[model samples]
Target: MSINVFAGSRKALVASIALAAVLGSVTASSAVLAADALSTASTTVTLSAKINGFTNTDWLNGVWRAAPALSIPASTANNAAFKVGASVRLADGQVRKVTKVYVVGSNLSVFLDGAVVDGNKVGAPNVLSAVTIATATTSPTTSSPTTSSGSTTTVSSGIAYASGINNFTNTDWLNGVWRKSAGFSIPATSASKSAFIVGATVKLADGQLRKVKTVQVVGSNMSVFLDGAAVNGSVVGYPNKLTAVSGSTTETAITAPTQTTLATSGLNNFTNTDWLNGVWRKSAGFSIAATGANQAAFKLGNSVKLADGQVRKITAAYVSGSNMSVYLDGAVLDGNAVGYPKTITAISGTSTSTGTVTSPAPSAPVVSAPAESTAPADTTNGQPRLVGVNLSGAGFGPSVVPGVHGTNYTYPAESYYKKYADLGMKLVRLPFLWERIQPKLNTPLNATELARLKQSLDFAHKHGVKVILDLHNYYRYFGKLIGSSEVPISSFAGVWKQIVQEVVSHPAVEGYGLMNEPYSTNGLWPQAALAAAKAIRTLDSQRWIYVAGDRWSSAYHWPHYNTQLINDPWMRDRKNNLVFEAHMYVDKDFSGNYFDKAEVFDPMIGVNRVKPFVEWLKSNNLRGYIGEHGVPDFSPSAIVATDNLLAYLRQNCIPSTYWAAGPWWGEYALSLDVTSGKARPQLPVLQKHAKTANSCSSIGPL
Candidate 1:
């Protein structure tokens, strides 16, 4: 924008005449040939307009610098001449002022500020010629701002508590520039928490724009995870304008949907103490923060696994104030450093993928359990079917009962062993100690103890009943009490191998019960137990091995096969030599009993009054056996199904060792007087059941 200033020169006169000739058929460049070219030019000619060889040119790239006529002052005309402020516009898109006025001859040359050609005219090639300035006014200079560098994302806080700000402004207001479609879909299979990316926009419940989240699906869920760093960000009213030419204008914007991010680890966030502590894993699909009404750890609408990866691959997540977060694909190794608001990063392990994720349709609900086989082997007549009992082994006892078992310190007497066979006991249970045999590392079994153990085994052989040797106490325990299954595997396995070697030759010992209730969790217990199984198999192939589950004696399914804990020949069990064990206490550490005293609480049915744990045991390869279960005398319905419980035992055609033979042993330990010779009412039930159990031998299901 500029004001025109010129001197007395022929340039101004020729410019006016050429402006007039562009509207006519006459050539405006005739003045250069016969001093007559002053017409046939565009009405808005630039002050430095170049008349290249003079034909009407296509170089119209300048702005007009004159004010509207409404702002003009009335001035007297002298000999058809008018005086007005001069505002010059050049072909380069720059508009300024021109002061000098000039009139040379019939072929006039234009000048500004009493000077000749202060700026250049750009028309056609070598055709820069102006006639005169007719109506002129003052032009002003104006400008606006625009982005020189591209937009970027920034986190105001640390990664642990990340926030997002896209299309964000400092002022508090709802901006529509950033919003996600109500039913937008992202890549994830299971419920998940997604990481937000920069430069993208998402819509909030308040209709404001936020950071957009791009996610990946991993292991039955989305790989997208949050980087905890969100501090402050929001929707701004407007964007800074552009400078230079005012031709095109655009505003920066970002709109996104409300997504959930989660930190799927650490026990502090949950109040339930019994809940297992571990990474719940971020699966494929969409994940919402704990902010919205439907915020959850998982969010799978239509998730599928990608071609290169396995099923939905989930990862770990961290916390960021209120938002939950998970990082996948592009995540860092330490898992702590992800660029803020960025969705999934690097990834390891397998991935899960599927369709879109949204709030409209919910994902399928999943229950934590191990996969099971479709069918189990049939039990036939006298085929040594799977059967056992939970001894509820006592932690305290006087001298062990003699002659029924091997070196186990706690035992039922030799006479009791005979009684067991008399009443048809097939498997005698004995839960022993972690503090005894290998008390501090390489300790060997004592001679006196070994002698006692042989005496007991001889007695069992004299009668007829298989003796099960259980490594009841893991070496990690300091005393008779149980320690965590988290002890180092090397020490535990070393001791386990020694114990296995000791019992391999014992004819009375039918099997070696591996770690009692080893957790199937992602830990060393299972791995170490499997190692012990390998050692046992290597030492004595004929004997069977028992392995218990993880928490709560979970026997359904064990850990993943990839754990490689089970040594070689894992699938090579032609002997059907493996038995998985479970211990069922009443719900809540002893809740109401499903059946009264005599009735059986078969977990085969659903989980109700009875524990459904036994069915879970069969789900994984291997037979199910109750290592521990009992009824309290306090239970009012003691003898209700004493008949059915006994009948069912017989119908299954499986052997069960009664929990007690000694008058005051085991459950009686806490109640009955040790010196009391009285019998528990359940003894009669066991005797009756044992008598009837043989009936199923001929009428077997198989």
Candidate 2:
């Protein structure tokens, strides 16, 4: 039988071969007859179970068996086919063609036609194509074969679909953005299947164009994956959704650029303990003071390699009393041992002060300006002194407190408020936990917790003392850090809203303190406090809101918070309705641990260092609160410093609250607990400034 042959493109070759089979007498086309010797040709065959042999002359019985190297089990469970006379493609773009085939264990192995190796083995499964038995004579004619332009896929035993395709290797796919319309259809036909191969890009119904990573075929059905996930549809009936993006379009992962100006002023106002201790990369305008400086260094931007393996941005130079501070990234790094990383080998500029002047010795504090302000009044009878003490132990954690969580609460005796009232105190700062208020995000306050808190408020009211509800969690909820990805600024704001809504109606509640000593990292405190302030104003619009600054709300860090405060929406929306809070402890380390001789005499460690902070507040026409201040009565220095600090607050008309008075303080140094109807040693100093005894009798609740 003469078989008609035609040589041309793949589509033409397939059609001519099929048509010629029906017209058996047709002659070979001139193109086919004059074609070069058959160097390469391939076809497809279904994979089947391996048999022992050629099946005892199965060709006569019309039972076709797999050729050698075709009996191996495939990598996947899906049906597969073989393409004969085609070269197997490897992942590295190398190809090896099979010349001879044989069965190896239920699998078949191919030999290189005649080449002999000890095992006659190349490998299993990496082979590209296979061939099927045909009736035509297996002979080659001489002619130059045509080379195909696009890739040719071969169905061979153990050959997985699109196994070596890499989208990243082709700049055409990776560099250009791709798209597809809604409801695009994917083709399931074999030829179309080859076009929508793995590593191709496809658009989803949501308009997101993602790379196709997974493809599966079972019988006639096909599934294509996008964004590492599969789309829902039958392969053939879906719309043709994918198209190469030609116009300007956005990449899914790339966002529009945003500019971040380096924090210049906030850095100078805040101290970074890390940057201060690190090796100073000093330059012409910046200098690190080994001893005290007569003149302040000129503020200049620089970088510091921290011990924690982070590079920090530093700016600003501050001379606070005897201690000098270098501000970095919105806070001062406090330490003596901080140094530069060894990797930083060079300094870019000289270290010098812009205006050097002779300075006093370390014993004398640098005085700035006197604190002056029209202090807001409190709910007192004919007087406006803020002489109340803090309730220390009730805010302890692990027990549920209304509007808070993670607190093990303690309730002071109802008589303590009366006791403080009897001492002529006019206000109380009631510290509380955040976890017990709203244990879960977006959840309401616990009813029982609210009742307990109301009881405390009633006690304060019964004693004629106004209450300042304090969030004592230090700007955190359990393990969740505010201003972070886990607990965003809105979470803090939302919780405050719940707290304010529940207690805004209470007459004894004078104000809300956002957070106590919010010493947070990442410059998050200002934003977090502002969010909470905004939330509170949404419901209780007219109430006074107190916001604490970063670095434990240190009086030293007041300048930074002042800058943030002026720019805060809360400040802009409600002018003269906000109060800045700061904490002070007169100790050697400023942590209220141990007192030095200068704790009393040296203004830097006591009353003098706060002059700049007070001046800043007064200059901005902003009122503030000494949220927490305490000095131990162990020595005369502590007593003297305590007296001086209170005098400073009273003289400036700044509302102030003593650190704490609780039943559990016992002998704790800073405790001002009243026991046996007698106050702690610090009580006399507190009473000396009471409304009736001082000039603050005219001030009232804010």
Q: Judging by lDDT against the true structure, name the best candidate.
A: 2
Prediction 2 TM-score vs. true: 0.44
The residue ranges of model 1 lying beyond 4 angstroms of the native Cα positions read 1-381, 385-410, 479-487, 519-522, 554-576, 587-612, 636-674, 693-702
Location of the lowest summed lDDT over 10 successive residues in candidate 2: 26-35
Best by TM-score: 2
The TM-scores of all predictions, comma-separated, are 0.37, 0.44
What's the true lDDT of residue 607 in model 2? Answer: 72
State the C-alpha lDDT per candidate: 0.32, 0.44
* C-alpha lDDT (0 to 100) for residue 124 of candidate 1: 30
lDDT of 1 by residue, 286-400 (tens): 2224344222332222111222222232222222234433322211111112111223322221122111111111011111100011111111112232343323222222123
Residue 278, model 1: lDDT of 16
Evaluated against the true structure, the overall lDDT of model 1 is: 0.32
